[model samples]
Target chain A: MDNSQLFFDFAPIWQARTLLLEGFGIAMFSAVAGIFFAILLGLIVALMRLSRYRALRAIAFTYTQLFRGVPLYVLVLWIYFGLVYAVGIDIPRIPSGIIALALLNSGYLSETFRSGILAVEKGQREAGEALGLRPWQVSRFIVLPQAGRIVVPPTGNQFVDAIKDSAILSIIGVPELMKVAQEQANMYYRPFEFYTVAGLLYLIAVIIVSKGISKLEQRLARFSRASKEASSGERRPSEVGG
Target chain B: MSETLLQLRNVGKRFGDHVVLKDINLDIAKGEVVCVIGPSGSGKSTLLRCINFIAPPEEGEVIFEGRTWKRFHSAFNFIANRKYEAKLPTLRAEIGMVFQHFNVFPHMTAIENVVLGLTKVRGNTRNVAREIAERSLRQVGLGDKLDQYPEKLSGGQKQRVAIARALALNPKVMLFDEVTSALDPELVTGILDEMRRLASDGMTMVVVTHEMNFAFQVATRIVFMDAGRIVTIGTPEEIRNTTEPRARAFLSSILG
Candidate 1:
């Protein structure tokens, strides 16, 4: 319980620094990959949901509903471990983990994307229509640019969630941050010390991401302010997700 | 120039069961500025909207360029409002609509906003589009402010940019929906002045406005509307000196 003993107990961490660093890299890699793919997938799904075609909307609704309803942890486990057992195919843990995270995040983000599209002022659409632009052209040029300004902040927060969610993949031997921390702690019988380091790493990662989001938001503010000048400043849809 | 360029016959619109416009009819001749004026709930704006197919009439035909746009029945109407998405781009190009709140594209500079539809929808090359955009901006007296964004521009400037954007399309009939209604008192005249110039330039226009003075001064024809129906249609002088109670009652309320 003494201070010297606590210091001695954590001495092994310096030796495991390389393992921890590599683990952090893997965690970040997974988060980035998941977010990148999810954003693309979510965008397509959202457009489908907003399509005039009833069948496309129904399909997008069903997909988002199915993936969002499933717990992320279960999804990670099923994709990584259940594939070999149930589907007779072995997916390497990293790719499998990213797939699960991307699918889950895309499901959630599709709704966020739709909300962003809807949040755009109706005048943008009318202006496009009045200007002789087709509906598709209207969405692409007029509505999407304005909606992009509103969607970036929430989409960024989703990236932070992806980073945290990446930890669950450690259970399936993904060699991410949590997995490395647990392995080091088990080897030295020092769970508290190693786990604390993992938690601090996550906090630092989240802080970095949040700061990046603020800067991106400021950059986009100039554009949003211009588009919204003529309309009444009401109903900000920026906070679509945590 | 006196030939009729656009005609609205028995135009009507409804949102579910609540009828907003009913059996409205109007003819807009080339080189004429037809101003529709009425109270807030009056269908002056709705008539302009129906003409542009912004609010497609449930029953009627809009005859423009000597070709009738069948607005209601899909079987006979060559272009029903919602059904003619294919033809809308062409139809809309011929008729420009300026909203009450100038819906300028915020991301683009004033010149770019004016150039966008010309380049994208009209398929004009960048050089040609820029030339048209510059000329249009100059026409609206925004030549010096072409690089400014909507937020940087005053209310009057934004409306002018909107007008320039619409003008770049070379629309046959420009539909203005209370273009100056959202401006400050001082800013209103700048937009009205722009309108006056456009009318003088021989542009056929259908304007829905609350500005009584501008309507009286500039409208070749004034259509007084109430509760979605045209109460009276005549020259500005006729409207000003009308004895019709419906017209007089509404004018007294607004002109007061």
Candidate 2:
């Protein structure tokens, strides 16, 4: 009994191009949309957490802690399975998946943003004040620009995180990449081939997103010429796209 | 004496258990440089901060123009005026401040730094703000370095840019907080020269400085503080004569 019947193939996936492409589209869509919402929510939560009002700080803290502590799968399930049916409202699974991932990412990214805001030096704030900038203006014009450069790497990681986490929403019946892979594997009884294909697709997507983010960071990093002298990671212009 | 431009009446401030400033009353007139000199922890900087309403003195009032600056709230937050914090940009625009460490915005060019307050707070057009910034930068002898970032500047040049930043606002009263303390001894003269030029131009200024010679030459009146109080307020000649023990001690300690 030489049970050596296991084999790998990419031909089947290629034949199922339309299905794979549609699933890829959904995955990409959710990642992009989720990140937009996450950054927006993170900005709001960060500001609230930094506010002088105790109640606001408490509320922001609760949102950050509760969501961050909960697993991404649990939050997605709670929103798609528990909240939707409980409210007796018929919502689409695609949007529900994006919302869950965004809400969860916001909780995580807000902490990143808060740390970034803190990274700004005390002198910069005072500089804005002495110039007579309003408090909000100082935060908007000076601190946020400085904080943004600091938070770039973390935020790029979060974007990829959201993209990968979007796959988990397939349990709630979202037709994302993982959903397509699971069905294809079951129908063809080739789990290895289907899963590996899905994984590689995600890797490619992440590489593109990561490279784009690094370029943006490079532009932002150029603003602080002083920091560059001390910063360890210096990108030579010739190294770009090499 | 000329017209009174700014008056601090019975101003007092404290930090937790320590009294940083108390019963600090001073009058500033137009075209006068009022230099506040004292030993460390003498509250000269704190008093300058209170003048710009940075700390919002816990006690007493600041009468500037026709408006009065007093405590709007009791909170210890960094916001200058709690109730009018929104409007403070306008008030602060009228009264500019230069810090000891030259707090120029590192992210912006020298010209951009100079014009930020004008465009952002004063609502001036971009072209108008740039023109004013360029002119002010020229006045500070940084006309050619307007495009340089703060990190590219020397201590003297950075402080000059900071001064230009404040000067662009055309403030009624300029507050200088140890602007030369952080510069090299050689760099100190450039900023002192700028201050002297400003003084001769009839700009009302309140300067908290450790530069005794600068105070002697430029200040119309000298205020010597110790232990969080103004020990003596007199002309440069009077401070030079040294009647008050605290002033004499501080002057001798610093001058020598």
Candidate 3:
């Protein structure tokens, strides 16, 4: 109960290290799973929003709005309790939590993707078409590749957010990093040290991811410059009118 | 008379409340070079875009290679026209276009830009596409730039790569929409010279240009347009001899 005891006791944390690692492992697993699904769903929704079909675009837009408008916490509860309990489905809590997080993350990520694709100049698409590529072929080869260059940084940022957001799954008793900290804090009566350590671990993970994304951005930049240099010889044909 | 390769009938375009072009009728023959000269916003570029189905005309039928007339209707809800969609791949293959901004794939090498159409659209093997790409680059006098990317190239070189990209497709008709308008003054002649060589080789070309000197030197027929309509269509000699007030004014302003 004394301030000195709370501040100086490394003993409680050392004793509970294994439990913390277990929670960290679970959080990391779910974050990675959530990101993979988020990327897949985001890509599909992004393409749907860009589709020529009115109904398809409308449906994609509705889905993005519905998810993005709701809070992540509410979404997790809905997927875990509302949908599962209402339907009497007996799916495990951890899997349900991951599905919920991924679904929610996808809505925001889809907007990122849609804007990225739109950011590519219309002329790039025309250039693709002038080369005789089919519409789908243009999207796949030229549009998507250029759009990826613009989307990666933001998508990476979202992944970092998802890693921290994984802690929300603890509310459903999924035993993620935050859940472990709570359990350790309660058992050893060391709320301040345990939670602080948990926070520091999350910070470290985000820093590593940030550095990796920056490296990736630099590599893409270099590739773009090199490609430009290699193709630098031809003169433009004269314009028809000026 | 030369065999007509492309024709437009009753072509019209409207963007919201603004009319861009109206009731345009024209014919282009095989291996002919037609130049369309007009002030900005006169629908010259839009007309070229309509031919390639880039900006589908609001009302018109386009006939290419003596084929059935194909109509373009604006789809209010779609990204592109769905009804008149068939044969787009084939039609586009036969028609190559270059834009004012060059619009080269910044991520691709010069040869990659040229070879992409050959390999992806024409189904040529990589080796064969590379050979053809190199040949096309050489034709544009950029044989040494096969490995360079667009950003590394000067404005003139980037536009040439764009030209070579179109040429590699071996399009039956080429459309140039102010291709050199984005270039520095000193670089304009280099691009113009390459285009002249292509014209001499009998490539069917339609150029929308501001450079009256180049048009006079290269175009077999020059069409002057204003207010979204053609004012006159004639050979350079005929245009040079015209006494029409508007034509005289336009010519004098440019010449001065």
Candidate 4:
């Protein structure tokens, strides 16, 4: 198509903005739902892997391996087609796709969380115990807070991945951003305009989310520094006298 | 004489085929300050860890507060082998430990670290915990550093804060594992001074230290370990004047 025609035809994106808005809304809803479940599942699996019980660790290991080994497309297809068709379950396509994404994302996120927990120095655990804290309390307060700092950057990356991966739900006819673009392209017979617009929208979303995460990281770092300064303030007078 | 607070009976630990500690039988009286001095790999730290049940002994028993020793089993092995097991958390409100590396929670402020045990483990109100934490920090001369994170503190400051964190729990016994070893030479005295104050306060303590001066000045008794066993246990004067060649050699070497 000619550049002028492409530009004019793409004007329909603004005119039919409600459709685009609806698509964006659906993608966001699915991404948020998927991430919430993914985090919850990831935390459980991570804890299971760290458990002192051999069977519990083995079970968690198997779950991560099985889900992470398969491609996202296969998982989505299996959930939408295989499970829904074979079991004759009446679950909607959107919910099914969300479950699949959450399940898949959790496997990878679990490993991230596990590594973060492990990265914390062993001495911290000992210190917690020395303070008479129970093992569970140690994990909840000392270990997890430190681990959260180490895990956030990677977890933020996974969240970005989750948002992008929501596009895969389009295959199940959930009418996400990519699917909307696809339908528009097919109807207008202008693949270049619609697909480019869709790609830009995705880029914008990712950029905004990533910037927000960076801001959060900076704020946390500053908070930590301020606390340190306040503590050091006590020693300054003593150091000068000495 | 103080009452016996902790007893180690035929305590032994092995990692696979390598024995780390063996045939350790000792009793520590309450309010006694004992210093353990030994070469690296002599298991001085391991023995300290065993007191708090940080490391379980493979054989024998540990008695605390005159109670009989209890056996704990591993859950992982039981799940794999289909045998029921018992896992116990042996940490009591009585025992507190500090490591050589000053393992303060990097994410928490100094006051928060000190208050964590009081509020979370002891079930104290937040205000009460904070009050106790501040008092402990003041005792350690860290009164102004209530909100500082570990990474921002110097080695000596961090170690002092760790001591306060332990003291905030109101532990009856405190264990120190070479706490000053990681400090800069100039900073070492600050931490040692704080420890000396703790010792003077009649806080029950077992300290593993390389600083001979600190041990000589502060320890009520000094126990020397070598090759995973206690070679000598005596007062500083006894250790200094002993005719035993090993004791003389160790003392001279450390002093030199």
Candidate 5:
């Protein structure tokens, strides 16, 4: 209670190390799963957006606009609390949190994929088809490989954003890193110390991810110099994840 | 002459409301080198595209190797489109096309680009595909550059790789759509010379070209088109002596 000197305590963080580590583990797991599912779903949505059928394109467009327009916080609440009451299906906190993260990020990822796919020249597709490669084979072999180079850097940024956004799941009592910090701060009356540790954990994750993305970009650049030219001066989407 | 290898009977094509090609009839014989020449937008490239249904004609039929490909209805032709889609791969394998831009896949090395069709479409083993791809690249004088990606290759080299890619399939006929238009004037001869060798080897070829001398020398028959219609079809000597105003005007303008 003495105001003679400003002091910080690391004792509480050490005392709550096991709980904090477990919470951080949960958060990392959620981020990985969310981004994984989002990528798969994003690719399908991207293909649907580019589909020849008007009905499929309409559905995909609506899905993208709706998810992207809604705030991630509101989406989490709607899926976790609102869906149970409105749809008569009770969902667990972990699944609800993961689903919300996936839905919100997928809107962004699908757009990334769509632009990536579009950036591939029309002639590439024609060349593949002229070689007698089937439509699917053309996409899998020719278009997507070229598109993958374009999308990798942006998708890596999305992964970093998803890790930070996972903190929002703590509000739904999902017991992630932020949730653990909150409990420890309240218990020991050391909010500053606990929150700082939590922030550092997230920063470390981001730095590691950024390194991996750069390595991947370098490997892909060997194939086409156009990708290097393409990666420059691209209009970045407005940040909506966290 | 030899047997008819391909026939385009009354073929028509339009984009939206503007007609690109109409009532086009032509016959190609096996091992014949037919060069199509005209000004830009003459539908010469469109005609080549139709040969493989890359831009399937809206009217009439394309008869290749005695098999007929025709559209039933313009609006509800998805059924026809689907049928062609299913049958096209096998036929496209036999009908090789080298584009003006040399659309060689950028992500693959020269050998890999040539090997793709053999391994994927033809379902050859990787080893066998590599052997064939090497042979094809060697034929195009690119054996030393087989491991190089498209970006590392020059325009003429890229075109050679594209030709090798098409050639690797051992096609019944080859289609060249302005393949030398993108190259430098100095680099044009390398490709034209390679094509001349192809023609001399008795490969059936449909060449869309602007090089008048190549057409006059290598082509067994020269087709002069204007406004989506064939204005003249004759031997090089006959085309040189044609009295058709449009054909005569086109030849003089370019030749002069």
Candidate 6:
């Protein structure tokens, strides 16, 4: 074949744009859902690891080890296929994909959260406790808020990873971005063109989300600087002194 | 002394085998300012911490307002520890503490830092907490910085917010753990003056400090500790004229 015959064509990509967009939507849904659950699950596991009880710490330790040691691909397959055969309960494709992503990411995120919580000064916790706060109240009100600030940048990276990892769900026929690309490529006999569009779609989503995270981090920092000055201003004299 | 407000009887603490406090027996009477002074490794901070149960006594008891906690709850004894955990908040509520680092919540504005204890622990409404926080911040001369985060404040200002955080709770006794140590030399007097005002208001307090002049002027009594034990304790005048060799040496070193 001549070099011209092998050149990239833009027509196939334009024709499949709608299908590609739908697939992109499904892929993002799984990632967002997975990230939401991962965040909550990660916090619980992190707390358990930091718990005073030996049993709790051990359990949390084992959970992080088991999940982190397994590849995301294997985890997705186990939930989608192994669970059905072994437990006689078949989880639907999308939910199964979400569960796998959540489980895998929670293991990494729990470690991230644990480090963030530990990064808070011990004095902060003591200050809270000194004010007669219950242990959980101290953690909830003081430690976690400070830890949340410390963990934001790292957690944003995890969100990006979740978006990329969502592609692994294609093997289970979840009709996510990768699966749609595969089907479109075969139907149109233009693998390179369809695949390129899917890659670009993922890249666009990631860039937008990362930009959003950066904005969020800036907002948090700004809020910490001057927030709630107005609420207490009711009692203050009109002069705002530095 | 009028009615003992806090008592530590044979209180002891250790990190592994290295003792931080040993057989510490002290009594803080109502409306008295007791200042603990000592060398760097002498356990003055740990002694103050014991009063608030920040560093729970490994042996003996801490009695506050007639209620007592004998050592901290153990993790091995889950059921009993749970009960102890429930009781601790009430016991600790009566005592307030400030740290050397001025550990104001970096994420919170000064008012929010002060309001947290009131709303969360005392169950005060937001309005009530705000009123109390404002009063406390103003008392510490931080009225202008009420909206500022700890990171935006100076060391002295952060310490003021920390003081306000503790004061807003209306604790029966306040513990100051080297509260002015982290301040710039010029800013030290402001914090000391704020503390002096608190002393004049008859707030029961236990202060661990390195500032001899402040200790001499404000403390109703001075405790000199060395090697995890109280070497001597007396009124400021008596401590100045202390005859005990260990206490005398420490005093001379600080004066120089």
- What do the candidate models score in CA lDDT, each in turn? 0.86, 0.84, 0.85, 0.80, 0.89, 0.86
Docking class of 6: acceptable
- lDDT per residue for candidate 2 within B43-86, as digits (tens), equals 88889888767776889988888688777555565465655566
Candidate that scores best on TM-score: 5
State the lDDT of candidate 5 residue by residue for A30-75, as single tens digits.
9989999899889999999999899999999999998889988998
lDDT of 1 at A50: 95
User: Per-residue lDDT for B1-256 in model 1, tens only?
Assistant: 4799999888888778877788888888999999888767776776787787776788887899787876555556544435665786788888888877788888889999988999987899999999999999998888899898787888889889899999899889898988876778999988898889889989998888878899999999999888878889999999989999989988888777
Task: Encode model 6's per-residue lDDT on B119-179: one tens digit a residue.
Answer: 9889999999999999999988888988887768887888889888888888899898887
Docking class of 5: acceptable
| Two-chain complex of model 6, DockQ on C-alpha atoms against the true structure | 0.36
lDDT tens digits, residues A57-99, model 3?
Answer: 9999999998789887887888888886798776687898799
Clashes of each: 0, 0, 24, 1, 0, 0
**For model 5, which pairs clash?**
none
Interface RMSD of each: 8.4, 12.7, 5.1, 9.2, 11.2, 10.9
Chain B TM, per prediction = 0.94, 0.94, 0.94, 0.91, 0.97, 0.96
TM-score of 3: 0.92
True contacts kept of each: 0.66, 0.43, 0.48, 0.43, 0.52, 0.59
Q: Which candidate should be chosen as best, given lDDT against the real structure?
A: 5
Superposed Cα deviation of residue A89, candidate 1 (Å): 4.8
Measured against the true two-chain complex, the DockQ scores of the candidates, in the order shown, are: 0.42, 0.29, 0.42, 0.32, 0.36, 0.36
Residues A1-242 of candidate 1 have per-residue lDDT tens digits of 65445644777678899999999999999999999999999999999999988999999999999899999989988887788899788889999999999999999999999999998878788888889898888998888888888899899899999999999989889999999999999998788889999999999999999999999999888887765554563232311100
Candidate 1 chain A minimal-lDDT segment of 10 residues: A233-242
Model 6 Cα lDDT, one tens digit per residue, A93-156: 9999999999999999999999989877677788888889999999999889878877898999
Between candidates 1 and 5, the one scoring higher on DockQ is: 1
Interface RMSD of 1: 8.4
Of candidates 2 and 1, the better by lDDT: 1
After superposing candidate 5, which stretches have Cα over 4 Å from the reference? A1-6, A226-242, B74-77
